[model samples]
Target: MMMLNIDDSGMARPYLRENIVFNHAHTEISTGTTLFACQFDGGVVIGADSRTSSGTYVVNRVTDKLTPLAKGIFCCRSGSAADTQKVADIVRYQLDFHRMQMDRDPTVLEAAVACRSICYAYRDDLTVGLFVAGWDESLGGQIYSIPLGGMLLRQPAVTGGSGSTYIYGYFDREFRSGMTKEECAKFVSTGVALAINRDGSSGGCVRLAIISKDGVERRLIKGDCVPRFSIC
Candidate 1:
C-alpha cells in the first residue's frame, strides 16, 4: 500500500517509504533569474541572467532563459524552468499554426494573450513569471509582463525573477519614457548585470534579444564583459 504524509502546508503527498524523510528544500528546482524587458524608439530589448538552481545547488549556470517564440517575439522566463519552458513551447507551436492559417505574422499582443491564457488556466499548478517582448508592424515595439497568477500587464519596461527585487529601485530611477535602441539595450544589460551581482542565485552570462522592425539581434555578454557596479 502507498503512504501519504501531510506536509507543513497541510497538503497530502505520496511517499515511497515510511522510514524515508522528505526535505522540500533539497527537492525543489528554481530558476533564480534576473529578467527584464524595455521599449526603445525603434523596438524592444529583453535580457536575462543565466542561472538555474535546485535548493542551494546550481544546476545550470549557463542556461538560456530568453526563449524565442516567433520571428520577433521572445520571452524571458523565470520561476520553475520546466513549467516555463513547456509553456513557451506550447505557445510557439500555436503561434506558428496561427501564422500559417492567417497568412501573416502573429502580433505581439496575440502572443502575450496566448501566454496569459495558458498561465491563467494552469495558475493553480504552475509557477511561472514571464516578460514577453517583441516588435510588430502595428505596435512597432511592445512589452508585456505575465506574472505568477497569470495577470497580464502592458508596460514600457518590466522586470521579474528573484533578482528583480534587488533592482526595482534602480530601474525606477534609471528608466526613462523614451530611449534610443542603443540606450535601451544598455539599460537592460546594466540592470541585469546589477541583479546578477546582488542576487546569489542569479549569475552566469547575460543573454539579450533585441527586436526591431528590421529584425532580431542576439547578444551574449559574459561575466567579465558585464559593467562594474559599486555603491559608495
Candidate 2:
C-alpha cells in the first residue's frame, strides 16, 4: 500500500482520498469531520465536530474528539478513533510519568514532541491526526498539529479532517494574531458550525475548549443552533 501524503490544502491527494482502497483496516481514514486549534490573547482554543462515520454511514453523533490529556493540555483526534485514543492514552501516561519524574508539568512543546516520537515509530501501523494545545507558565498558550506519519507543526491556526477542506477559506479571511479568548472562541465555534452545515461527514455538536494559564475550560455548541450563521 502507498503511504498517504496530505497536500497543502490538508486533503489527502486523490490517490489516497479513500484509504479503503489501500486496505480494509484503513477505511477509518475517511471518517474524519473537523478538528482545529488556534491561539488567542489569553490562551488557545481547540474545537471539533461530534460526527464519526464509516464511509457514508454515521457511526456516532456525539463523539467528543477534544480530550484533556492533562491539566492545561488537550488533544483533538481526527482520524481513526480507536488508534487516536490509544495514542492519546500512551501520551497521557508519558506526560504523567514525566511530571512525576521531573517534579513539574510538561510544556506543550514537550508533549507534542513526545507524542510525535511515538506516532512516528508506529506510522506504518496506525492512522491518526491530532491537534495539541496547552498553556504553561513559560509559554502562555500554544497549538500544534500532528498528522499521520508524525509531521508535527506549530501554527497560529490549523484545521484537520474532511470538513477542513470546506472551511479553510473562512479561517484564512478572519484569522488574526493577538485575538482575545472570546473572539477566538466565537471564530472557532463559527468555523465548526459552518463545516457541519456543508460537510456530510461533519455534524452533531461542536465541542470546544479554551486552555489558559489556569487550565482548560470546555463548552458545547448545539448543532441545531449552528444554522443561525446562515443568516448572520
Candidate 3:
C-alpha cells in the first residue's frame, strides 16, 4: 500500500512504503573503459584503456581489460569490473575443458558463443559487454562483438564503452578492409587515445593484444606515449 502525506497546501503526495521491492541491478552505476577490435588482413588487434571508474571516482588506474579465453582468442571487457571478470573466468574454464575434449584449440566463434550464453543468462543481473577476437587455421582472423543482452555481431571493426561515443566518426573515416598489421595497430591505438583524451571516465595507459597465427603479442602504451589531439 502507498502512504500519502498532506502538505501545508492540502495536496496528497503518494510515497512508496518500506515493503516495496527494488531491483538493485537495474540501478545505474557509472562504468568507463574504451574497448575495440579490428580485423586486419592476416589477424586481429584488440585494445582497451586501463581506467576503471565508479560513478565520478576513478577506482583502478591500471586494470587489464583484455582477457584470454582460449589459445589465441582474447576478449576486451567493459562494464562492471567484477561482472566482466567473473564472466571471463567462467568462459575460460569452459573453453579449456572443450579444448581438452576435442584435442584442439576452441574456435573464435565457439568462444564467442560461450560468452553469449553466459551473458544472456544473466542479462538482467550483469552489465557487461565483450569483443571476441582471435586467429585460427580455418579462419585467418575474426572479430565478434557480444554486447549487453547477448546480441552478437561480426564486424571488421568495432568499438564500445563510454569512450566509443567520441570515436564513432573516427572509425568511420579511418577503418578500411585489408589493412596491414601496422596500420591496424596504429588505428586501434590512435582511436583509443583519442577517446581517453575526451572521455572523463576513460584514461590511463592503453593495453593492446595483437593475435595472429604466430601467437599473441601484448603491448602497453604508457599515458605519456599516447597520442593527444586538441579538441578545442
In model 1, how many backbone clashes occur?
Answer: 0
Candidate 1 C-alpha lDDT tens digits along 1-232: 8778788899888875773565645666888799989999889999999989987778888999989999899988999988999999999999999999999999999999999999999999999998888999998999999999999999999889999999999899999978988989889999999999899989989999889999999999987787767877
Q: Which residue runs does candidate 3 get wrong by more than 4 Å?
A: 1-31
Clashing pairs in model 2, backbone N/Cα/C closer than 3 A: none
* 7-90 per-residue lDDT for model 2 (tens digits): 678987546455445344445634487887889877899999999887766778989898877778888898777888888999
lDDT of each: 0.91, 0.85, 0.89
lDDT of 3 by residue, 77-173 (tens): 9888889988999999999999899999899999999999999999999989899999999888999999999998899999999899999999999
Winner on TM-score between 1 and 3 is 1
Point out the higher-scoring one by lDDT: 1 or 3.
1
- Model 2: how far residue 156 lies from native, Å: 1.0
Would you estimate the TM-scores of all the predictions? 0.87, 0.84, 0.86
Candidate 3 residue 53 C-alpha distance from true site, Å: 1.1
How displaced is residue 186 in candidate 2, in Å?
A: 0.9
Clashes of 2: 0
RMSD of each: 6.6, 9.3, 6.6
